[model samples]
Target chain A: MIEIKELIKNYGEVRAVDRISCQIAQGECVGLLGLNGAGKTTLLRILACLLTPTSGTVTVDGHDVVRQPEQVRRLIGYLPEEPPLYLEMRVADFLAFVAGIRGVPRMDTGGRVQQALQRCQLEHMAGERIETLSYGYRKRVGIAQAIVHNPPLVILDEPIAGLDPAQIVEMRELIRALRGEHTLVLSSHILAEISQTCDRLLVLQRGRLVGSGTEEEIAGSSGREFRLEVLLRGQRALVEQALGQVEDIDERQLEQRGPDELLLRVVSSQDVRAQLAAQLVGAGLQLLELRRQRDQLEEVFLKLTGSKEGAS
Target chain B: MREVGLLARREFVAFFRSAQGYVIAALYLAMVGLDFNLRVLGGGAKFSSEVVSGFFFELSGFTMFFSVFISMGLIARERETGTMPLLSTSPLSDAHIVMGKYLGALLFLLLITAATIYMPMLIMVHGKVSAGHLLAGYLGVLLLGGATLAVGTFGSAVTRSQIVAVFVSLGIGTPLVLFWLLGRYADRPLNDVFSYLAIHNLHFSPFRSGKVHLRDIVYYFSVIGFFLFAATRMLESRRWR
Candidate 1:
């Protein structure tokens, strides 16, 4: 378990992390969602013991980060934005070295390295020097080094930041495979990556945690109406009449596509897509198409982080 | 201790795998060899003891210069390549990381210094030279190298650029080297203090002449200890930044 209480970190006159507090239960995979200067890196660095907090306390599994950093470090594996790798070493040798320094038993170092190699699917690149590998391969090597010691918690920052679409998918699967074995804390600015991979999301804005919960929970907390785009093959007056009958529909806008086709934008306090479709069909209208608008998570994130761009 | 050993081993292997280490070693050996051939051998009618003493004198100067090159990249390169976070976030203390890097650089220094043995052995073959003088001279070179390397390690810890690290070390080391010249113009106790603090003039002269004073050994070791402690403290202070 990880417990952070009113943690604060300052750089000169600027407060990078301001009085943030949270608790992560065992075996939970959480994503930290934020913008560029949202204090995500600073918070992770403090948890990793790379930087000391200016105030408050962070404890990992009963060990205080400031007072017993080494003990805390022993329990967690951290992969920074840029992977901390030695390019001169071969992949296998590098994993072995990390395992050794991370306190893997001498007799089991080779076995542990082999397991990491397999876990990261770098078994074929084991003999290759890290400098010769491509960026995607290097990221795999970074993940391999982090988990070589079988740490209880693994913290990854921007794990899929620069990968291609295919690589991102592969990386997502790999992260998902690490779910049961270790508690994970991953940070990213990409909303879909966080929504797809993480069980819960902690949103930050300008150095403060703005909100945290599951996708639905966060959307519910935002108190925003659910939006749907309805395409109907009927009269606009009948569509408006059907929308008025629905109790949850707060607002509706109609755009005439043609003589028989109309587009309706419906906002409701709850998910009323099924009810809206049934009402339109029952009111002597043909439902041509009905689709929910963009993901509510994006809306919740943008509103929370105060960004105009939806997601990238 | 085991963590220190592991870090040291990694750094030691890194030195051999990188081009900078080989280039530095090769250039140092070539320059030292050229000096030995031109000055020690080319000068005519020199006694074997004088040749040995001159050899130590020239080698100590080269050791000081090359130690700066060897140690300048110790921590600075890690920062440049973004690998320092691995060590900082590990379960090891700052002291262990500094000590391990120092030991690894010192070991490489020892290897290069030991390779210069044939120069002294050549003198032993052609002329009469005392084994005691040979032992004393190598000890002086190694100790001086250790001190200069510690200064360079501190320099590396203070900055991220290897070039800046070298300049920082030279900035700190050049003053001590010139302290002997400064002592000549000073008066009374000031002159005495400068003479005592001089890195080469008063401190290393005895070892060059086949005399191993306990005070000189203590001075070199104290220098090594002081700079290494400073390097460790610099590393610790970076967490605040």
Candidate 2:
């Protein structure tokens, strides 16, 4: 379990993290989504015990980060954006070294190192120097080091940044594999990345928690209507004219796929898919596809960040 | 204690793996070898004691000079390369990290300084050498090296550039060396104080002459202790930044 209360971090005069509070339960995977300079890195660093918060408190598994730093460090593992590693050391040697520093017992270190290597799929490159490996392999080594001691809580900052497409898929799979074993907190500016891997999202804007919930909750809190896309067997003009009759649609688009196939997309404040299907059939058109299109992750990110840009 | 051993092992292995460590060793050996030939052998000194004393005197110079390079990157390189965060975030305390790093650099210094023993032994073949004299001279060099390396550790901890670390260590060391001269010109009480505080004069002279004074050993340890304490404080204060 992790809890942060009124966490504040300041860099000179700039408030990097401004009095933010959050709680994460055991075995939960939470994603921190934010824009550039949004205090995500600062918050993560503070949680990792790499940087001290200017005020407030953070505790991991009942250990206070400030008062019991050694205990907190033993319970948590951190992977910074650049993946702190000694390039000269071989992958296996580096992981073993980290495991030692992470306070893993002497008798169990070898098995722990092996487990981390196998989990990250780094067994093949275990003997290779980190500097000699490709970027993807190096990242795997980074993740391996973080988990080599099997800390209960893992905090990853921008783990997917600068990774190739294939490597991204590999990393996502690795994160998913950790679901049962560790409570993970990962931060990213990329929305799609968070939505794909994280169980919940904490959206921050200008050093403030603007939203925190599941995808549906965030979308609902945005005060924006869901989009409904419908396909009907009728003239596009008649369906377009009928959609225009609906009073609450913010916008509507009608497209003709064939002589009888009409595609209707409507942005409204409410769920009108059922009413639209009935209206299409009552108007002598065969109803086909009638479903509300969930807002894209990108659109949700924009709404969360764009709304704060003007006021902040 | 195990953490200390692990960190020290890591640092010591790094020195051997990089060409820079061998280069520093080679440079110190070349200087000591040239000095033994030119200053000790070239001088028309018949007594083995004179030759041994000359060798110890010259070796101290190399020890002091090379100690700067040996400890120059102890903490500064980590700060520059951003590896300090890795150590800082570990479960170890600042004191453990500082002590481990200091031990690593000190061990490397001992290895390089010990390698020069052959030159003094070669003198032993031609002229009779006292085991007591040899041990005393080597101890002096180690003490001087330890003090200078501690100062360098302080320099590294206080800055992020190895170049600046070297300059700062030298800047602090040179003044202590000159304090011997200041002692000569000062009045009674001030003269006594300055002479006692002088790094090379009062503290290092007895060892070069085959005399192991308890005061000299205590002085070197005190200097090392003071600087290491400063380095530890500097490391701890960085958490606030």
Candidate 3:
């Protein structure tokens, strides 16, 4: 549904979005994983036709963002990091206004606004003035306005940025509900939020696409180290020698946990537990408590970006 | 046009929804009433035409100020409140958005201009006045208000702060009105150029006297068009910036 090629956006001396390229499929929910200053917002803005790429081209459904912005804009709905809202307007009225400008047929605008309100779960607050609503509801209104026109591709920049835990959960469900019907592309520095909400992940680090795929695929991509704790019925020195024989084992620390048992912690470039088990059996050792230690999203993100800052 | 209308209607209604809009309108009406009671009536019995002319002449100044007040927030406030993305990402062109905002402010100005009709209508009850004259004077008021509002809209587009927008508007317009004074002291061709460019004196005088010259009409539209176009250009530049 979206194609971006070598998109570079520069502001005089500062290159906000460097040579980044990625394709998002129709009906696929793709999350752009990056910390602040990782060019997530700049990239989304370029796709939404709000910013022109300095050197590359971005197209939504076949229309070029630069050459045919109005056409591309018609197919995509965008929510910026901060929800663009008029506080004085009522929830329903504001959605209607957005729908009107988005070129929803005049006769269909009401129905569209109603559908948006229902989908965003804002029906209870439809008549409430936006200024009176809380920040979370305002965010929901922002989502409502974007989808009010029922665009095929929805680009949300940091959709769950400033929400509380409960609000984040609701937002996740709301974004997930929009998955199959509309091609969803959302960006977030939080690994768990992006991983749980999106089907595919594109990890951006310092304005470059470092990895792209599902969580497990990215975990197993390359250069990822797996930590394993194996309890063995052997001497510490013997367990260390056996683990040393296993290939891809980067480091090993063996400790005597019991009379005939040793707790061997092995850090390998890959999942070398099987190799270690085979080698340990050949060395006359019983393997116990053998497992790979890695959190699903955090491990994959740390492996791809190699940054501890976005662990949140 | 439909999009412009939709935007304009929203803007016009906003004036009723907010206390600031009503406060400004009340203050303007109070001042107009006071000026009518003091300067026009207290001066003594005068020609009905003079009273009418005097009203339009002074009302012209207030019209300029009113336009500035109404238009200061046109584009600037949207930027300030972070709502510009709603308009910027839409399928509409910059010209349409600018025109929509201008028309919305103009609608409010027109309503405020309409409210002052009672002051002119009182002339009909007390003395003889031509309907053509009232129409001509009102047309001039609309044109002057429109021209000033367009300039203010341009100012609002160039800045994100409404106060800065106000000063920028007055900075552009105050000189145009004052150019008429500069024309009186200048020599030959320069004087002619300055007088021709003066938004008020040479252009608006003919309309105040119930004479609708096509030249003055074109001048008002040209001012309105040029500024609105400039505002649209500013938006286009900022959108990609």
lDDT of 1 by residue, B1-241 (tens): 8878988888888889989879988998999999999998886898998999999999999999999999999999999999998888788889999999999999999998998999999998899998898999999999999999999999999999999999999999999899998899999889988988888888898998899999999999998999999999999898877
Report model 3's interface C-alpha RMSD after superposition on the true interface residues: 1.2
Against the hidden reference, what TM-scores do the models get? 0.92, 0.91, 0.89
lDDT of 1 by residue, A56-92 (tens): 9999999999899899989988899889999999999
True contacts kept of each: 0.69, 0.44, 0.69
Q: Write the per-residue lDDT of candidate 2 for residues A187-206, one digit (tens) a residue.
A: 99888788789989999887
Error of 1 at A268 (Å): 2.5
Best by lDDT: 1
- Candidates, DockQ: 0.71, 0.57, 0.65
* Pairs of colliding residues, candidate 3: none
Which residue window of length 10 is worst by lDDT in model 3 chain A? A303-312
Where model 1 places Cα greater than 4 Å from the true spot, the runs are A229-247, A251-266, A272-292, A307-312
Q: After best superposition, candidate 2 residue B236: deviation in angstroms?
A: 1.6
| Shift of residue B188 alpha carbon in model 2, Å | 3.9
Model 3 agreement with the true structure over A1-312: per-residue lDDT tens digits: 788898888888888877888888899999998878888888988888778888988888899989998898899899999999988999999998889988988999889999999999999999999999988999999999989999999999999888999999999999988988899999999987788888899888777788889876777784466878887886666676776687887788888886877888888767676788898988888777787664645766766677433542
Write out the backbone clash pairs for model 1: none
